[model samples]
Target: STWDSQGEFYESEGISKESVKLALKGSKMREELFDHYYAEGGEEAVSDDEMVKYLDDNYLRYKSISFAKTKASTDSSSSATDSSTDSADAANEEAKAKRDEFLEKAQGVSFDDFDSIIDEYNDYVASKKASDSSSAADSNSSASDSSTTSDDTSSVAESDTSSTASDDTSSVSDSTADSSTAASDTDSSADSSSSAPDPYANEKMMNYGTMDDSQKDTANGKILKEVSGMSTDVATAYEDDNAYYILIKGDVKDRDTEYAKDNHEDLLKEMKSDEFQKKLTSWVEKLDIKVNNKAIKRYTPKVVYDKQTEYYSKNNNS
Candidate 1:
């Protein structure tokens, strides 16, 4: 109501109340959807369309998939088997081979089996995290017992500097930071958040359209875009800085018509811009035209202004 009484002020400010209303309306919509989702059984009862729309609106839901790398003993599996440089090269190749094998396995996974796979994947991740954490604590205990650097699984320290190659809702990373002889890292009471094993480190849960425009131009983003276009039935392969990925896109809903209508003012401005000047001039020249200069001069300025407002109000809605 205040806006109605202060039309000139709004015109001068150039702020669209419709856009503000839409932004604020998001919270209410989320609350309603939460109620709606639970009213139906959380998973089985939710329709395909409902899931698609929820994801399209950027909710943190995803199809959880496993990504445990298979260990096949290679000829130079250990550094002692060869020279230092050669051994390191062999280890890298072995890791790549294992990662590629998992990617291949992931590509064959059907969308229907995704729901069934979640429990197994979750259990594996939870166990791996527990084991890594136990190993770290034991290493720290031994180091403290006998004043020495804890050279146990550097996985505890590695997680600290892991690359953020995952867009999973759980936010695990895939980097392997080198363990240093620094005594500070040997503390059994190191920050739990830093030492905790990343949830998606050994699993691959695929998310969609999570990257910004800048990321889309990168090799990572380009590959993700390619996966987004594929059907959910078939998985697609990609990789980032520290990890390989096998992702399949989720179902998506069409763009909202109501949302598009929010940009009608922009559309109107573009149509009236200088780029259309020649076409507009041609339309005016070809169309029937009339002048009422002498008759118009009889009406007051306020009456002419009211008429102009009425004309725009009718045309704008159309």
Candidate 2:
């Protein structure tokens, strides 16, 4: 027996120290006073007094928690809260009813029926192109009809100024030049009129080594990065913020090798030039470099005449 803080001999044999530790481990309701009473650093039973205190404290804590919960429930069951909840419920029901009515009109959406729908658009563009060609032919026919009116007008002018034939010819030349210039300025360039632009033009054969973060995010870059590992004909259904897309991968070619064959030397030269420029800039910034303004001005080609005169002088000397 040991004299505790209470100065009493509290013996224990029912609960082991290991049992108390295990109970405390699984419980939030712990009395650290138990540690003060019987928590020795060895295998021994907790004092019966400490065990009694632990159970009593846990029961008191449970009662207090239950009282707090009951008070909260009573406070929250007020008329205002109930009215707000009812209003929210009514709003949700009304929104659901409207959605149901809309579904009745749009005839209910179906899953597993969505696609890129690009083929239909391509067909529509081809039809429009054909119609535009027919319209252009009609416009050319109208222009041909206008030319007959111009012929009669020109004859009338020629007759009125019969003696001044040279003057009339000069006037006609000026008029023709103005009309041609106007036509040249106003006429639209022949639009591509292509049924479809090359889809692969934007994504074919990336030089992935030179790509930066921004480049990796552009030109279907995200899609290409994924498909780079996949074999041809093994595609993925990809989606983004705007729309869903089905990426059908094409045959792999050593386009990178072919491109490097033609352009590797030029690319290397450009890289070397860029690196040299960066190094030069860094060196210039660090070094005490002052420009000889007099020398620069003396050698500077301010104008072509300034250099041309020297060239002429050299030629004269030679």
Q: Across residues 1-318, which tens digit of lDDT does each residue of candidate 1 receive? A: 545754444443343667446655875764454434333453324343544443355312123332322222355647544554564445445545644554565565665444334444345456655676777777766656775465643332422111111224222231221111011112223335796743323222223244457655655445445655667656555444444445544443332232223323232222223334564577779989998887667556776666567656755752
Look at candidate 2 and give me any clashing residue pairs.
none
Residues forming the 10-long window of minimal summed lDDT in candidate 2: 61-70
RMSD of each: 19.5, 40.0
Q: How far in Å is the alpha carbon of 5 misplaced in model 2?
A: 99
Evaluate all candidate structures by whole-model CA lDDT and list the values in order.
0.43, 0.34
Poorest 10 consecutive residues by lDDT, candidate 1: 176-185
Give the CA lDDT, 0 to 100, for residue 63 in model 2.
4
Per-residue lDDT value at 317 in model 1: 52
Top-lDDT candidate index: 1
Model 2: number of backbone collisions: 0
TM-score each candidate: 0.35, 0.27
Measured with C-alpha atoms, the lDDT of residue 292 in candidate 2 is 88
lDDT of 2 by residue, 1-318 (tens): 112321211112123455555665655332232233224441333433443332222111000000000011123657867775665445444433432333333222121111122233234335545665677667666666677565643211111111111221101112112111111111112225765543322222323333456655753445445555544433234333322233334332323233333333233332233444565577679998899898666655564455556655655652
